[model samples]
Target: MACLACLLALAFVAAEAQQMQSNISQGSSLTPTTNSTWLSRSGLYAFGFYRQGNGYAVGIFLAGIPEETVVWTANRDDPPFSNNATLRFTGDGLALPTAEGQNYLVKPSSTPSYASMLDSGNFVLYNSSREIVWQSFDHPTDTLLPGQRLLSGNELFSAKSEADHSTGIFRLKMQNDGNLVQYPVDTPDTRPYAFYSSSTSGAGENVTLNFGADGHLYLLNRNGTNIRNITEGGLPTDEGKLYLMRIDVGGIFRLYSHDLKKNANWSVQWESSNDKCDPKGLCGLNSYCVSIDLQPDCRCLPRFEYVNQGNQTSGCERNFVADACKNRNENFTYTMEELESTTWEDVSYMNLRLSDRNDCIQGCLEDCNCEAALFDGTNCRKQRLPLRYGRRDTGTSDRALIKVGVPRKPDTDPRIVQPGNKKKGRTGILIIGLSFTAFGSILLLISVIVWWKHNVWAYKRMSAVNGDLELNEGVALRRYAYEELEEMTNNFKEELGRGASSTVYKGLILGTQKPVAVKRLEKVAAEGETEFQTEIRVIGRTHHKNLVRLLGYCLDGAKKLLVYEYMSNGSLADVLFTRERQPFWEERMGIARNIARGFLYLHEECDAQIIHCDIKPQNILLDEFMCPKISDFGLAKLLKADQTRTTTGIRGTKGYVAPEWHRKMPITVKADVYSFGIVLLEIICCRRNVDWSLPEEEAILDELAYNNYHTSR
Candidate 1:
């Protein structure tokens, strides 16, 4: 009897929980002027007509928050309506009457008995049988909730701004062709031009994009099979953590997570794309976007001003119109303004037969429609007005020619003094002169202090290396200050690779725009100082096509950095092991030969006899043309011509270190030869010598090579 009573009590609780209370009856209505809302049973979500500017929008908002957070908005792209707006639930469906007196039905197909605001923030209309006819989840605005399916027919459109609930320029859509694409709203066609896409082509039919409860956004097939994990490595595991995938105002699709215990606000975990300039319509037409300190800044071309001074996306317009072709005036002559590394991709253009840079400029001048001409050495591409996707590239050698009118002198001074105010003007001039003198003195003092501090720092750094060290003349290598190196590397933002001794970063020299690889060494001890000095001495003077050149070094207090010519292809290990495609047989043979030639130069051609104790694949860097250059001479030891070997501790990497190193015997140049032979075998076999993935018998490359040699004999 007791068990029966307990089961009855549990059943009652479950029944009560499943039942939902209707926020609006079958014949009820809501008006915009009333500022009325229908709250969910849990009191977490509400359905209402919210005011935006002078108009109103019917949307779902998180009512529990201090500030109204609208998760979904209907009629985002439609023009806002005034106080006459009404949302009425009828026998047919839910009808939204606009200020124009036209009624738009929410779900016109089925008869809805009532409307309810669910805890999930979905506003739904249910029939007599309690089947969902329509819901807000199917038509999301900018944000995606967990368990919501962004279907093929639906799209997530970002809002213009935080204050404005109007449709923004950016949108994310699940295309009919199985690819998920994010594009600017103003894009003419469905196909992506500059937009970001999932690139999962040919998987479109019956596909659903879902934001999972585990904080992963997934693209699923009809049978609920995960086609792709969009947020591959950034899924949140903790329960009750709020996660949202939103297409932000900048057109960036970002996955954000919020944990009340850990953070006060939401933190971005992943984004669709990191290149801010790739998005189309970022800055309006006639303007170019440049990353200033990693932030996007828009600038207009010559002879143009911002269309709207407050908004950069409004683009730019010409201050003066071009001269008429029929009546060409002498005062309206064209001047070419060079814009380097700019490309207007996919914009229709007329190809010019002219090859010379000046000829291309003249060609653009001849055509009335041509706003600019781009010359990329081989071809001349002339573009039309309202240029889009204008960006500056530091890597390429393309240039844009924009024709501007001849310079004109101003008619009169905007600032003028009356004829009777000569005495007052003189007094003002004296005050201005005093202010200028004071400003100049302050600037001069600051420069002197900076110069003096730099000298003191440089003196201390030089003293640490050598007491009588002079970098004034004769030496080919330059000594750079730590701060200069930091600036060059952009505070070491892009790390190429890291080893046990140091980390390498890609950097550009300020004035020359020369790319360099800056290797920042670990804090120096007495032994490390010796190695640093040895590297500077050996690689500094030794110049060869097969050896990496040391361009400069930095030694300020504890900071030690070595700058070398940037290797575009990176280390041999990266190509052989990390990359997906293996180098061709011809390329492999050439690389092996280059390594041998580098060794020959180090051993015989150089002024000093140097033995590179560590000659592994990691130290061999490849140039832009895939030519191998031997690098990392920190383990190198200098010896006399007669001296063949020297006593030393073990230094080279495992598996490549010579047998003599293990035997506590004197190290010789043969140690490099041993390591080189190992590299050659690994390159040929396309496998590491000591790889555990292989059978124990065939693991060591050197041993296998020896066995093959014996068998052949």
Candidate 2:
């Protein structure tokens, strides 16, 4: 009788525990079919299938929230198919692979059999007694809802271009030193320390300070004492809405609070970085970043001018467009201001008393592959570190050193001359007199001091930096200073527009000594910083005359801007929509050809797979030569060269977006081809894709634009 009662008690306790499941069975495969969706108990999240260009995948969504926000995903970089995919709760976690039988460890199938959404908002796969096996909190996309910790252990990555689900060049995670920083994958060795945080005041071990209550998030010392509150929710506008913050895949860390007033749309309270050029490598190679207008935040780096800068994700290419090896002379380089960042390189540190600039240069001139050299106008330096060089996270402007090859040795150091033997006799007498004046004592003291300082500095740098050269002189770009940008924009006068994350303005570039356009981006969280840097690097490498030129970029704390050349005419959209702005037939074809070439370069020639999610004529720009230039890469994507396709959320304007776009699909180079065909039809008919003015039967492009649309099929 007692044994029976014990069994009953065990069953009762199991039944009392709250259970959260998306489908038919626990520890069994869940195949989503025939128009189905799964939701959590509190209705805080959901998981199911979605369709896109030509494929499908098992995906996630937030429940109860109006915004179809996706947090943790089963098939992000590569999604499952539309026909018969299964989101199975296996012995380990959840396995939602493609019906075609492709494999991925979305949630490794091991130990934890159950997945649940905790009241704290963290969604995880749990074991029998509730130990976490896998959790959505580990991997983040664009947003971090409340109850989720932004900075945890060691996993972070940039979201694919606002649309795609493939991995990107940017990454956000913890550093060995325990501070938060952003990194660009391509420039990993450089270790550019764009930002840094510490738990303690100045000398203690660093610790992450996260959100605790209703308002702020801070970074305090290891002791939890000296708090550095980085975010705050002030004013009545943010009241009532709970705020959650995290770094996004786009290289931004933003504070999100659902707007109770407008369908609960998310609002940004603050961010850690900005999105001017989209990132450090926006254009590709051999280019500079420039702001298109006078906007401070909307500027680029130097050596570039804007040709086709429209909308959010863009930067400038090179002005000359030097042909490969053909116009080798055209690849001349301009100096860039060293920044406090890391690039991959081994470094060593040395100290020297104040000296002349020439002496410093002479010191660094002794290397062969010395990519660069810098000095603080006194001490000389040479760094073997590759990829990049700059100051540390504290915004150092003090010293500079460089590693450069022999500077041809101006006339062999100028041999020293001396009077003949007559002077030699007098010299010998003078030397003997000075010997008694305590010269030996002075020399001994100087040697001892030098020895002690060198050892001390060597040990210090080993701990603080990889290695160190002298921080004396450094390369400086002609880019405008933060103050100069403010003055140029008349403090940001003409406002062109505003969007989900940034604002636009007009400004002038300083080094080029020309007028340009600028965009001032609002601050982002840690997630967006890597993308921002990458965009800059891409733009810096690309060189094309017709392409928008990147003049320069500025990263002063939260104030980030990109500079670009000004285009007299607006976007291709303006030209197409307004009769007066429309170009002639020849011009239209030229625009098409130009855009195609740009796409070809991105898709075929770029180091990675490039896809333009939002491709439209409006993004095309015409230069003084009337040459068309493709612009606006905010939606541009980079894929692993081997992959056939990637996953992403739905983006782009209506009608123009592909049919499979609304759901998960294999977005191919054909996707861009499809949009181009539509643009061609618009050029042919001289009308919009969807027009109410036309007879209902004739408007949907189904009746008139078949020639181009069906051409591909």
What TM-score fits each model? 0.52, 0.40
> lDDT of all predictions, in order shown?
0.71, 0.49
By summed lDDT, the worst window of 10 consecutive residues in model 1 runs over 425-434
Clashes of each: 1, 156
Q: Compared with the true structure, what per-residue lDDT tens digits does model 1 show for residues 52-143? A: 87787777886755456788877666666677867777887666755566466476457788788887777888878888878888778899
Candidate 1 lDDT score at position 424 = 20
Candidate with top TM-score is 1
Per-residue lDDT tens digits for candidate 2, residues 43-76, read 4555556553356655566555666655555546
Q: Which whole-number lDDT from 0 to 100 does residue 27 have in model 2?
A: 51
List where candidate 1 sits over 4 angstroms from the true fold: 1-23, 31-35, 81-86, 96-102, 188-192, 233-239, 260-263, 353-355, 407-713
lDDT of 2: 0.49
